[model samples]
Target chain A: MEPLLKVENIEKTYDGKKVLNGISFEMEKGNTKVIIGPSGTGKSTLLRCVNRLSEPEMGKVILDGQVVLDKTVEKEPRIDLNAIRSQVGMVFQNFNLFTHLSVLGNVTLGLTQVKGMKRKDAVERAMIEIDRVGLADKKDAYPALLSGGQQQRVSIARALAMDPKVILFDEPTSALDPELIGEVLQVMIKLAKEGMTMLCVTHEIGFARSVADEIIFLDEGKVLAHEPPEQLFSNNSSARIRTFLKKISELYGGE
Target chain B: METSSGLMIIWESWPMFLSGTITAVQLCILFLGVGVVVAVPVSLSQIYGGKSLKFSASVFEQVFRGLPALVLLFLFYFGLAELDVSPLVAATLAMGLRSAAYQSQIFRGAILSIDSGQMVAARSIGMSRIRAIKCVILPQAIRLAIPPWSNEFANMIKDTSYVFVVGIIELMRQGRYVVAGSFGNALLVYSVIALIYLFLTYCGLFLMGRLSKKLAIPGFASAGAAMERI
Candidate 1:
């Protein structure tokens, strides 16, 4: 079967300093891949590049056999960017829920606006996702009324309501409080169990161990190590990956 | 001229003052409503539109905001009278356009205060920039604009009286007429009209205050509006 999403040689530079240099990866359908790295290691940049949010100077990102951003195609042909972005939903570290909208409104906005679904149908669809994330009771509550974890779940519900082919989590739990992290991770674990294709940039070692099919260790814009969770956790992993993992577990362990 | 009778005599102009107050309110509503409709797009241009649009919007802001109300009234009333525009119409257009200038800046600042994160999230969910601004950004920004917006409402209420100079006969012009015909102490009559103006201004502000409080963001203070006075 063909890879569901392929990111090839994605090179991005910031202020003449290379942030993502020759990065490449692929996710087959139902695969969950986690990216782990030190700060400013181009992890977040990779995710943004996937959706063409931060335009990579050089790269090809193809989703579901369609070229999202291809240098060769762009010389004469360009993809419909909004259509591509809709298929690839993204969750942010800050949970970035619309402040003025209620939980139901947040989930339903993209449905009614982007997909052009009728209001009644959109609300029906939004309720399913809202229920998936266990936010049915909070549907009328505004983002300001929610805790960090609750807001993140609503954001996840929002992405799910779009019925995306793949979801990108840009350090999804990074901004979450420690106690709140488990609730979001639980929702994610449930998503993975149900075969949701996901690409997560996070330091949750426990999540990578239990859920990610593979974990790629990136350092300074290069993927230094890519291995299965079993080998990665074992001593067979790269010394760099080992050191980073050991360091994080010692600092914020059992995540 | 007796102190007790002075009160009874000024009451004779009550009908005039009442009509004047109603006209003044109508003028305020006309301009303030127009200010909102025009200012939103103008401010959006300033923030998100291309260079030419931004430049044109700024020029609009400067010309309307820089000119005094009296000059705008003069320019519109005198400028449009040649085409047979009525004084009230001319004055409403001028004040409304002027309020739009002030309001656009208010909205612009409020829009800017929102975290860029709000935008990124909107885009991530497949929303176009315009859709995101409409569905996500502006709603929050508009809420933030409320406190300052109410301040603008109060301003327009008093500014409604400025039309008197152009012969619109709102409160001030009507007050002047009543003062002219009165045999009672002129100072007492003028004072009563001043009090009526104060009453109108006060009542309008009270309603606006209630509105701002009702619609304020659930948790956050109106931080976006707070920085705008400078």
Candidate 2:
């Protein structure tokens, strides 16, 4: 079976300093990949490059057998970048929900505006996803009214309402209180169990252990290790990966 | 010494003053409507449009902002009267254009004060930049712009009095007529005139205050607007 997404030799530079240098990876359908890295290690940049949020100077990102982004595909693109982005949902570290819109409005905006679904149909679809994230009761509440975890769930519902082929989560729980992290992680774990393809950048070691099919360790814009969770956590790993995991578990384990 | 006579003159001319006030209100509404319509696109151009568009918007803003309101009225009224534009139309257009320049800056600051993450999130969910701005950015920015925008409303109310030089009989002109027709009552007549202007300005501010309270997002103050107040 073909992979649902393939990223090849992606390279990104900012101010003449290389951030992502020759990174490549692939995710098959129903696979959950967790990316763990230290700060400014190009993990966020990699996810952004996948969807062309930050234009990578060089790379090819293919989603579901279609080239979503490619340095070579310029001069006339077959697919609209907006269309490509619509298919790739992203959740941010700060929740990034529309503050003016209610939870339902936030979820339904893309469905009605981007997909051209009727308002009635969009509301119905949005409610289903909102309910899926256990936010049915907060549909009418604005982002400002909801807690960070609640807002993040609403953002997830907004993304799910789009029916994306893959979802990119960039530290989705980083801004939440320690108590609030579990609720978001629970929704994510449930999503993984339902076989949604997910690329997550997070430091949640336990969540990675339980829900990730594979964990990809990135350092200095290079993929250092890509292996199953058990293999990555075991003693056989490289000193770099092992040391990084030990430090995080020590730091985040209390939370 | 002449207070009763001054009061009497004002009482007698109350009908004219009332009509003048109505006209002033109409002018304020007209210019504000045009100002907002012009401002939205101008601000959008400065914020999101290309280099040429940004340059043009900046130039338009600078030209109008630097010109005195009286000069703009004179330029539009007497200078352009050969174009067959009525005094009322010309005056409104001049004020509206100048107000648009100010409004555009206010709106652009409000839009910029929004967390850049909002735009990123909107785009991440498949919104084109235009769509994201319209759906996500403007809604929030408009709310944030209200306090400063109301200040503009009050400023425009006072500025409408400048049209008197072009022979438009608005509030200030009406007050002048009352003063001219009376003797030894200038103080009383002028006091009443100041009161009327105060009343109108307060009404505008009160309504805007209510609007701000009604639409305010909890815990979200427009940072740019707050700084602008200082």
Candidate 3:
């Protein structure tokens, strides 16, 4: 079967420096794909390119059989950007919640505005998602009042409120405290069990190993390795992967 | 003790003074209302409008803000009289245009102080550029804009005195009328005018203080409180 999302030879350059150079990947439907790399390896850039947040200099991004980003197909390229954005929810490392709005307001904004749901129905739908994230009691509270974990959960709930086909998480728990990280990871694990399609860039190797259907190791804007957890973790395919795993194990202690 | 001159002046002209005071208050209200109406959209255009528009807006802001209000009023009332405009219309245009310049800066700073992430979040949720600005950005921007806006309003109150140069018969013009009658008692007449101005300005500050407090976010209490102290 054809992939749900296809990226063909994407390349991006910023101020004469190549950030993404001839990168390619594909994700099947309902599969959790985890991308791992060191800092400044253009992992975030690659993710943003999928959504056209940072346009790739040369590439094709096909989502659900639609040519989202391509040099060809030029009939008002700006058309349906918001539609595509609503369908593909994204969570950032920083929660990025609007501090002026209540938690419920933050979650319902998209539902009412984008989906054109009535206020009452949107509020009710938002409350259900808030409950799912275990933040029902904090619905009226502003982002400033919530903990880092709670804020990230609210961010997740806000994204999920759109009922997106796929969710992109860019280091969702990286900004949280060690103790708070588990709450976000637990939420993601629950999402994985329900077979939600996700593309995540993270440093949490354990969570990636446990939840990812396929793990793609990236380095210097190129795919270094791609394998399932057991095979990727237990066996050595490349010296680079072996060295990366050893360094990560020493830093984070893998069992 | 003098010769009942001051007493006669008070008795015979009290009605005129009262009527002048009423008109002065009306003038203050009208000028402030016009200033606010012109300021909001001009401010938004400067801050969120694109590069070329912002450049033009900044130039407009600097030109009016740098010119003296009395000079602008003279330019309007006298220079535009050849164009057949009335003094009242000229005063309103001059003062309101000047207030728009200063108010735009006040609002621009407030809007800029808000987190850029707010706009990003609004866009991510599928709000179009106009809707995001109208619904999310402007509400918070206006709320944050209150303290500086109050300062602008206060400045407008003081600057309304410049209308006297165009002979629009506002407070300062009324004071000149009293001084002309009370010839040697210029100090006493001007003191009464100052007291009236003090009353108006203080009342405005009190109302603005309450409004600023109500609009301030809890997380921003310290900054708002600091501004209040200022």
N/CA/C clash count, model 3 = 0
For all candidates listed, what's the TM-score of chain B alone? Answer: 0.92, 0.93, 0.88
Residues B37-85, model 1: lDDT tens digits: 9999999999999999999999999999999999999999887778888
**Candidate 1 lDDT over residue span A137-210, tens digit each:** 99999888799999999999999999999999998999988999999999999999999999999989899999
Q: How well is candidate 2 docked (DockQ)?
A: 0.74
**Which lDDT value does model 2 have at A132?**
99
B1-230 in candidate 3: lDDT tens per residue?
A: 43367556645666666776777777777877777777777777787788987788888889889999988998898888889888889988888888888887777777777677677767776778788887777777778778778888778788778787777777777777776787556666677678877888899899998997787665645533444453
Task: Evaluate all candidate structures by whole-model CA lDDT and list the values in order.
Answer: 0.89, 0.90, 0.82
**True-structure lDDT of candidate 3:** 0.82
Docking class of 3: medium
> Fnat of candidate 1, please?
0.72
TM-score of chain A of 3: 0.95
Q: Which stretches of candidate 3 lie over 4 Å from their true place?
A: A72-78, A249-255, B2-26, B220-230
Point out the worst 10-residue segment of candidate 3 chain B by lDDT. B221-230
- Put down candidate 2 lDDT per residue, A1-255, tens digits, no spaces: 889999999999998889999989999998999999778889999999999999888878889988887775565357688998999999999999888888999999999999999999999999999999998988888787789999999999989999999999999999999999999999999999999999999999888999899999999989999999999988999998888888999989922
List iRMS (one decimal) for every candidate: 1.2, 1.2, 1.6
